[model samples]
Target: MNSAANAHLINSESYVQKPFTLPNGIVIKNRLLKSAMSEALGTIDNVPTMKLATLYRRWAKGGVGLCVTGNVMIDARAIGEPGNVVLENDKHMSKLKLWAKAGTCNNTQLWMQINHPGKQVPKGLNKNSVAPSAIGFGPALTKFFEIPRELTENEILDIITRFATTASLAKEAGFTGVQIHGAHGYLVSQFLSPNHNQRTDQWGGSLENRMRFVREVYRSIREKVGEDFPIGIKLNSADFQKGGFTEEESIEVIKTLTDDGMALIEISGGTYESPVMALGSNIKESTYTREAYFLKFADTIRQETTASGLKIPLAVTGGFRTTTGMADALAHDNLDMVGIARPLAVDPDYPHKVLSGQAKTNPIRAISTGIKFVDDAALMEVAWYTRQLHRMGVGKNPKPNEGAISSLVKTLLTSGYKTFRTRRLRA
Candidate 1:
């Protein structure tokens, strides 16, 4: 074994040795969690494919304590992306169990992230998306998405029930938990954002009214799954876009969840309008350039909440890829867990590499700098190569030569009309 691997096995004490206990008493052995990343690997009918199972099995063996599946749409009409896994009925229970087994190979906890795309729905996928209000996603980015219809009061209630039903399915599928995708300007987030939820009904107008949907969803899940089942939420600390969900509103929402017995709260920010990809524009840049992306905001939330005597486990993710940096944030910043996304997508065994001393720090800079965000054609090519690396138990990194094959693979993967390709194609 290499020195790094040897060290990981021999070292009794390490920086990442800390564990986080969830509300249901489920304990995560380490702080590292694989944040949800959309792989677009599901079947056209929104079922889990063999390739999707293979992709997760590789990540399961990578050593992260927790792995959250990409957006599992609660409403079939409200799909986040074209190929997102949909979990609206019991028909997928067996397949989901298989997926759960593959994802939990290393005793790692696997959580399904439930979401509704709302007005952020891409035009090509669902031209008639739904939101709390008829407000568009601003004039600049309206071209990226279609005009969304405002959901009726009954429809909102039905959607909330759908979230609970999905959570129940997750429990039956043997998933460790379910994470409500309340961040990134999704359906739940649309209600949270003042800009998007401009309604005169009971579901809008004030922060409490806006938060009613999420609160009901959370409560319904608790009722269905029982008190001991873990239920997590990913929330935007702030929208970053003007006239949107602000830090003040976010803090209030956090407090409400804490009071209601949330298992964990993962803090993130940004929307389609002020996308986090706009380099150096928001606090995410501060995480890379300054350190602890939500350090200031988190501190304020923590101090005030602590002063008020509320103790909820808080997690922060975005631009985190260093052992020293993560350790510092956990120790000094009062954070309970750290979430990592793209890095693990590239290297599934990154957590093991870090723990075993094979790698001193997360290789975020190299991988992220190599990421070339381009048009759909370019992105498809990149996704193809990424799928290959994921199956081989290797992390994705931008390699120039892989682009040609990736381009071909992307077309094959996205062509919904094609029959299921054999697993050999993935290998």
Candidate 2:
């Protein structure tokens, strides 16, 4: 497509500060969605803390139309990290209500990203990690994560119920919406990967079967929330691994949900193993020029789905750093919203800056010491960004200029020790 044709395709200015309406009739005030980032601020009991309320209030005031909370594990026994919040029952309603109010002030929609960590659960975190098939994280990841056992038929049925229960609890606690965490190699994501899910039963093997878990989870949540409440899903464009969940399969899964009246679909890719979703990967020079890392695949989706006469509300997250990139994607109708994470971590008011013409460019600071190994550590990014969130949780401004090495040391000193000591995992 020529620049003129691209300009003609979806004029880049039409959606600057535009309000977005989901298919289920929920109208977001703007096109920016605060993508889910693990806050790890819960109490020892896996309950929401006042710190979470404080942190979200900051983001609510930051001008995002919708804010998706860090991953809320559906079952307490299975968690990806030490401070992960779990919503298995209504016991934490009061704290949840407080978090909800802070997040929903000014008409902002706070959608809880509910998930099950499955085999991704760390060693010693839980007695036994489980998945669609008994698979171990390959050699590179084995040291950090435990080998998982295959879930039994009964266990699978119970997990589906757990998802619905959490969704119902979220609505009761006053959240505006719920997003199923079906991406980034969580439980649902694992099921989608042919390499991970090898069962011949209805919940595995074929693509249709592999998708059944997510489909059923969506249906269960819908039943609990009724038809009016919005439900969104964050899905991978591809797993970016050989013999893993393919881009073609992802489109098919998306179409199935779109046909079933899914309200929103956010595209993200990679997992803890590949970690491309965190912007760590070999990239083409052309890719760096684009705002979102997944837009190329998203463009492929637009082509395929439009040919089928379907238009789903799409949001693409990752590598978005400028207004021009955001505007072009929205104007061209490639995506309905921009899912901003790291940029929002440091500057909560990034959407405001973009909409109000104040932010020219927010530089993504490289976290490195010039030592190849230290620079290449995956936990370095998580450790750095997570500390920034803790600062906001405690009413402190994010130390965006903090050195990467110091951030990692502080995080290990603070969260790492506590995480290792806590047996908060579900039994």
Candidate 3:
């Protein structure tokens, strides 16, 4: 198609597109966002590294509108995984500034995703991981995570403040926005999911109660940063595991967030038992078979928003590969943005390719990272790259753990590191 024709396909008024605007006036250069993918490259102290800078610089240059940093923990003790950058103090501001500058070099919006591990934290990292309630996720698959301790009401409030403080730090460090990581069975997702959150207090039991912590966190962040700073979240459309967070409940939560002034909401799903979002090698193959695995759920939410007259922008990730599919989704589905994680990892310039009409199909393959099953060679290769980025000062270094390679790979997958060669595998 010619430029003018393609422009019409993308938008009617012009053949060229403009930036996507969030509620708070934060404008992304385009509809593409590099979804948060954990690099596990932070320093031993969990500060950002030059390797992280390198990684983001590459992605920023690739042409995505926004690049979200992976898992910057709000509390040191509640880390989601080893090597996750902890954002508890102002001391790390310089490092964060470096990361932001590197990531936004191409005028891309850079958002740091703040989170807590809750029960998902490995026992090796903290034997007493805190949660909204004292509940084990399921059978102990690893020696790492023990039964987590329940957070006191005071602890909950402290965590809320921590989120706000972290957002303030991110803003100071030069981030364009902040994304609360509330998906994939982390602390915030744990509280949102009924199966994990079994508390009797105001923080649990009912859907409204389960959503209270996230609401408070959002309110606190808005209060600390004011309305101009963009705030977004990644939420599960459904947990997929039995008795966990469901589509029905997720819709309700999205509705609540829309009312609470969320600028963007990315739809995702699955948790430990299922691990859908991370592995991408599920037997169900939702994204492979069904384009945009979370579309049905997102459509329901969008319908709800339209019916109720809500205007928050929605970004859908997972199983979005083809440019035509993405364009069709934005034009027909009413979704404001498209999120590409693994494909962007393999080919960072994918968005530019799509927009320039060079590529029409998604480049992601079903190639397994082989780390999912704890392959030694695979683990070592991933560790080497992770450490290499750290050595290069792009991010922090994850502790080498052969058994935890699956989790490590999951983090990498979330960050967009899909292409690899066995020859590149090294410890």
Candidate 4:
């Protein structure tokens, strides 16, 4: 309750409460990290707003050691959603600085997750989408997304520069660090997926070439941000799609990044096409019951990294639901941090509850619209959670028990309207 009492609680002997120092010498006060969740709280012009500051300040005070903001687009023309913040330059530096300050309050480490949506952009949201190769999605997704144009070599180089520019601006705005959104079927992930990247150039065709984009992006950012600023990445253990990014390739990428001096590596799985990150589909049944869908894979990577003598801090996101599960994973040395996303949307102070031993299990549950079509679409859950984030942006508490169908309808209407507005502006 009080500062002294809270400090004592945080300094407890529990594994979850223990502070850990990153290789960059930055110390996170505890092991709890609020993983990136698309807040969609930016302004229509794709600029940071005070609502972001308000929402993150709440999470900062609620007690997360590290809070990673949702994907901030590196390029305005390649936005994944309508309200995503685009950090192309310093035009909105003042607002960005405000958000950074609020999010980094109470000794929290706020990292901005930078991304480019590639062909994942919703239809009509962007005039055109680009990827490593000119390819279209499979039948189910084809109606929602068009075949993206293959990025020219010059365009690819420009994008690498854009990633660096965004990271530089984030550091200048006072964000403690930046995480490459190299997971989740975004641009970086698309480059790594053989199913998506069919290019025959130096940037594709082989595992080394496929991963060249991410390696270059990381190097560019590190060059701009300098050695002291922490730079991490959220990578997929496997894309869970046939001929997609594989576990073996993911491990190789991890080793390469480690060799390049990555400060942290957060493991995740799935893409928009497979969408297995939250559902735990195809993961081992034993790991599912433990509440960490990727723990088995994480442990394997942990062993590999230990054997290779890579000292990069590792984290795993998705399916972390209980305090016991979070603590036990750390006690077993599976990961250095616990990445919680949707749970914090419902209860912002969840980390404090977990640390104080007042909360054993997380309150998150499967959200369903009850309508088969709506429930089948993975956007339903994200929309429901986004509504909670919008509530928080307005200084209100999240409605954890909110009806799923109502949220679905609201999201559909809102998304349709935003898409129309975005298209009109482009026109």
Candidate 5:
């Protein structure tokens, strides 16, 4: 542990395998937190399916301290991707219970990641997306999304209420916690970015205004869930784009979350345009060499949290692939927990493997297709990984050696394509 970076070193015991207690009195069984990944496992009508339960059941038995489910939309009409589960009402209580039961088995804490896509909603699935301003994604993503309309004040308040309603329902279900999805260019993230949110209203313009949406969303959730239930957030260290959300703004937001009694804040970066969360970039050397996509920012955040004597737990996700890096980061108090997503997709038990020293190295790799279109779209990455998840959901082992190009073609030509089209065709 380095004293210069952090005043205290994580104890010698493998912090990854120890229990982590949040400020809210919710104690996670371990430091290995399974960060959110868009599962694409719901029915066309936005109900959680048994397949989703089966997949989560596997992860629960794998011994992760916390498992954050994919983006469950607050409104059915504003989904971020195909097959996203929606908690807009109570009609799906049975389905929610079924999914939550399996996910939280064996003492694993399951938290639903609630979100609204805003303009990130795909083109064919939506008529007109709503945002802080009438801005569309840049030209590269123009064809994939529609130009968004600026949200009215009433509509903005309605969305905030929806978030609270959804969080209340999540608590009613078997979920132990709920995480507000304020990153990855989702609605809250869009409002936080000055580049996307250009409104002159109270919800936009200055840094305080731009962050208002997220603050309100958190306050709403906290109102419903109370003090004991854990409320966390997955936020970006920076948007990693020119004139986008900066590290300084992000640190301020972290401080705000801490003040608001946040249980945890998972650090990640990039939006659709930057995609640094998935592909990464050269701007931060620690992201690659140190194996924490947001460690550089995580260190600064650690210093901030320590200086303020805030107890809110911080985590770094995205680039983690080895135990050594995880240990080092944890030792220096750069982060309190380790977040791994893609690696767990292929091997649900990777956490156990790392803990037991059975796996010597990280096997996670970048997805690619020989053709330009599939590779450039980044949908290939999602489709390729979906294959592995489907395998796990169906009680089969993941085929990590499966060809990416073949997987894309099969998804487009087979049941995966049908399932996707079924959801989109209805919209």
Candidate 6:
């Protein structure tokens, strides 16, 4: 932490430690939310292990108001990564209950983040990838991801049903709430982007048509979980790619979701092709001073919704690195909660430190492998942080100064073996 930056740090005890209630009446004990991280800590069969319980219990006791789990795949056949926990039925009900109970300790709210990867699945990881259109990635990303086939209307309906089933099971397993992984260029984000969804049916062409899939998914889940349970979304403020999901379109989607009774809307940006969500490569220098890369768009949406008499809770989750940045965002009264992700990977008790006024700045640094292409892809950073998560899963403290290149190489080899096993099982 820089001493100059520390000079600007303010006491966060009043703002970040305050409790907030959702529209559905669920109370979050504080404003610090542990945003979802892709903790690939599951069995070879994609079952939730006790390690997840242990890891989340640490976060629960860390004093975060809400803890959203990593992406849990809805279908076993369409996995985005090697070790995603699939929640299709009650066969793993006991394991799910254990994870929920452990994570919901200290009166914390544990929400399950449900996702479908669609064409974002790595090449050969699944039997075949499916999306709204039979489109592939741009030249740079084509080497890693395969071209997906267009999904049929029946297949689309089946996926909607799958989302509902997963949400219903999560509620039964005792999770406090659920959130749709509608950001980071996943299945839901692909449907919302014109650059990805080039279909001509009722599910594409116009923005309304493109958003119909997410609207249906939300409706189905709400019907299954009832109005009292909170159902939120992690949405992209903009895709940051040409002809992609823009800020204006995102605002319209937010308005529609607000009208549709959504509980919260977390703001993030970029895709696998752009990968700006974590890197903040395209952000302005002025925005960097604010510490949150997407604050401009978040402020704009807050004003837009306030004018329309909608009080939707908003959280923005990238490039936040200091107590001053977090407190300033809340002091403006535009953001309801401060979303923290990578910091928690290194220090699970970061929330307690911030709330107790013991820490002024976060201990986060740029993660790079010194290789241009590897660093540009943001692979080294994810690999390094995921290694920290694994350390915590096994009851060890995180090594914040771990070597990035080593973590990248180790993760690549492990992912290669897992992909081979997945292909063999599918065959």
The collision pairs in model 2 are 10-331, 76-426, 77-426
Candidate 4 lDDT over residue span 1-427, tens digit each: 3443344334432778889899978999999989999889887768888999999999999999999999999998999998899999999999999999999999999999999999998887888999999998888899899899999999999999999999999999999999999998999999999999999999999999999999999999999989999999999999999889999899999989988988889999998888877673223457455778788888888888888677658999988876767766776788999998988999999888988887755578768766777676678888999999999999999999999988888988998888788788876
At residue 351, give the lDDT of candidate 2.
Answer: 78
lDDT of 5 by residue, 358-378 (tens): 657667765767666667665
Q: Please give, for residues 1-427, the per-residue lDDT of candidate 6 as tens digits.
A: 3443343354556678889999888889999889999888987778999989999999999999999999999999899988889999999999999999999999999999999999999898888999999999999889999999999999999999999999999999999999999999999999999999999999999999999999999999999999899999999999999999999999999999988988999999999888878875323447565788888888899898899898878988987777767877887775888888998999999989888887666577778777777777776688789889999999899998888888888888987898788788777
Instruction: State the TM-score for model 1.
Output: 0.85
Q: Could you tell me the TM-score of candidate 6? A: 0.96
Off by over 4 Å in 1: 1-13, 277-289, 365-427
Higher-ranked by lDDT: 3 or 5: 5
lDDT of 3 by residue, 1-427 (tens): 4444454465432211457878777678888878887777765556676777777887788788888887799986666555578888788678788888988997889999999878886445554678888877676344536778899999999999999999999999999899999998888999998888999999999998999999999999999998889899999988898888988888888888988899899988887666666544233454354567777777778787787788758998877776766766665554788887766655666777866767665564443345555432233333433443443343332232323446455556743332122112211
**What local lDDT does model 4 show for residue 277?**
78
Question: Against the true structure, what is each candidate's TM-score?
Answer: 0.85, 0.95, 0.84, 0.95, 0.93, 0.96
In terms of lDDT, model 3 sits at 0.74
What C-alpha root-mean-square deviation, in Å, does candidate 3 show against the real structure?
Answer: 6.8
Clashing pairs in 5: none
Q: Give the local distance difference test score of model 1.
A: 0.74
Model 6, residue 89: C-alpha shift (Å)? 0.6
- List clash counts for every candidate, in order: 6, 3, 26, 0, 0, 0
lDDT of 4: 0.89
Q: What stretches of model 4 exceed 4 Å from their correct place? A: 1-13, 280-289
CA error at residue 36 for candidate 3, angstroms: 0.4
Error of 1 at 233 (Å): 0.4
lDDT of each: 0.74, 0.86, 0.74, 0.89, 0.83, 0.89
